[model samples]
Target chain A: QKEVEQDPGPLSVPEGAIVSLNCTYSNSAFQYFMWYRQYSRKGPELLMYTYSSGNKEDGRFTAQVDKSSKYISLFIRDSQPSDSATYLCAMGVDSNYQLIWGAGTKLIIKP
Target chain B: DAGVTQSPTHLIKTRGQQVTLRCSPKSGHDTVSWYQQALGQGPQFIFQYYEEEERQRGNFPDRFSGHQFPNYSSELNVNALLLGDSALYLCASSLVGADEQFFGPGTRLTVL
Candidate 1:
């Protein structure tokens, strides 16, 4: 199995809808979790970051990590069309020097 | 401050050719890391450079090599490029002890 697994979602959601993207991992040593958003033809942009298990909120975005289940999620509240992009979940063992990433889930927030 | 900057925003090269891509870390940052993002995939770490030395590397083969300069800028060199080497090459920068990486507009390489 891949170290990190994420659904290759071309998930479409209507604007203002609640959006939830998730990934599961096999490594228990991963302690730092991150969410990145990438627009077409652009590099992945850092969105949310967290250490271990917990919930972090940034405006309309919320990231939660469940170490027990080896799963992590990014929730977008009141999604907008501008939010359409690929979302990637990555984990680091101890520091930022090494990060294991998942195949991103592509999202489309329709107007 | 300027974010990470990569040169030759787009490149087209024939298979078996070699190419060199350069990156200047974000202002005030001292470490540089390179990643490869294939179509429909998340960015994969290739390697990282700190203090003019290779600090970490991912699963990529020896055909993929890199260098860090005294000014904290870096270069990624691909030798014996294959069709599979075509991808969006991304450069990211972070300060020492800083975990979050800020990325540059990547260089898109197309191996013909």
Candidate 2:
């Protein structure tokens, strides 16, 4: 199994809808979890980061990490067409800094 | 202040040729890392450079190599590239031992 697994979603939703993207990992040693958003032909931008297990909120985005289940999620509220992009989940052991990444989920917030 | 910057936004090369991509880190950052993102896939770690030395490498073969300069800029060189070598090459910079990383727009390489 891949170290990190995410559904390669092309999920489409209407504007103002809430969107939830998730990923599961096999390694329990992953101490740092991150979410990145990438627009077409652009680099991945860091959206949110969390250590261990907890919930972090940043404006319209909320990130949740569940260490027990080895799962992580990024929730977007009041989605916009500008929010359309690929969301990637990344994790790593804090000491090594070598992140294992998921394939990314493609989300589109249609108008 | 400029974020991470990569050169040659797009490249087209024939198989068996070589290509070099460059990256300049953001100000005050000393470490540089390279990754390869294939179509419809996540970025895979290539290797990392710090203090002008190779600190760590991923599972990539020797054909993939890199260098870090005193100024904290970096270069990724792929020798005798194969068709499979075609992908979006991304450069990331960060402070040493810092978990957060800043990325460049990436160089899109097409091995024809």
Candidate 3:
């Protein structure tokens, strides 16, 4: 099984709808979790960063990590067309900064 | 302040050819990491450099290598490339021991 698993979704939603993207990992050592947004042909842009097993909120985005369940989630409120992009979840252990990434879920916010 | 920057926005090469991609880290950052993102996939970590030395590496083969200069800029060199080498090569920079990393625009490599 892969270390990290995420649905490669072209999840379509209306503008102003709430969107939820999630990832699951089999590694128990992950202590740092992050969510990144990538526009087509562009590099991944960090959207949220959180330490183990908790929720962190910024502006209209919220990131939650559940170490016990080996799951992480990013919730977007009031999504917009500009929010249409690929959402990736990445995690790292305390030993080194190397990150294991999810396959990413593509989100489309229609107007 | 400028974020991370990479050179040669796009490149095309034949199989077995060598390619070199460059990156300049953000100001005051001392560590640089490289990743490869294939179509429809997340970025895969290749390796990371700090203090002009290789600090860590992922599962990539030896044909993939990198170097970091004293100025904190870095270069990724792929030798004996195969068609699978074609992907978006990304450069990310961060302060040593920091959890957050800033990424460059990336070099899109196509091996035909």
Q: Candidate 3 at residue B22, lDDT? A: 99
Ranking by lDDT: 3, 2, 1
The top-ranked prediction according to DockQ is 1
What is the iRMSD of the candidate numbered 2? 1.5
Q: Candidates' DockQ values? A: 0.77, 0.67, 0.66
Error of 2 at B111 (Å): 0.5
Write candidate 1's Cα lDDT for B1-112 as tens digits. Answer: 7788999999999999999999999899998989999988888999999999988999999999999988999999999999999999999999989989999999999999
For model 2, how does the per-residue alpha-carbon lDDT over A13-62 read when each residue is reduced to its tens digit? Answer: 99999999999999888899999999999899999998958899999999
Model 3 docking grade: medium
Score residue B15 of candidate 1 by CA lDDT.
95
Query: Which is the winner by DockQ between candidate 2 and candidate 3?
Result: 2
Write the residue-wise lDDT of candidate 3 on B27-77 in tens digits.
999999999999999899999999999998999999999999999999999
Root mean square deviation (Cα) for candidate 2: 0.9
lDDT for each residue of candidate 1 in A1-111, tens digit (9 for 90 to 100): 999999998999999999999999999989999999999888889999999688999999999999999999999999999999999998898566878889999999999
Going through the candidates in order, what fraction of the true interface contacts does each contain? 0.69, 0.53, 0.57
Where does the lowest 10-residue lDDT sum fall in candidate 1 chain A? A92-101
lDDT of each: 0.93, 0.93, 0.94
- Worst lDDT run of 10 residues, candidate 1 chain B, spans B36-45
Worst 10 residues of 2 chain B by lDDT: B94-103
List model 3 lDDT by residue over A1-111, tens digit each: 999999999999999999999999999878889899999988999998988678989999999998999999999999999999999999888524789999999999999
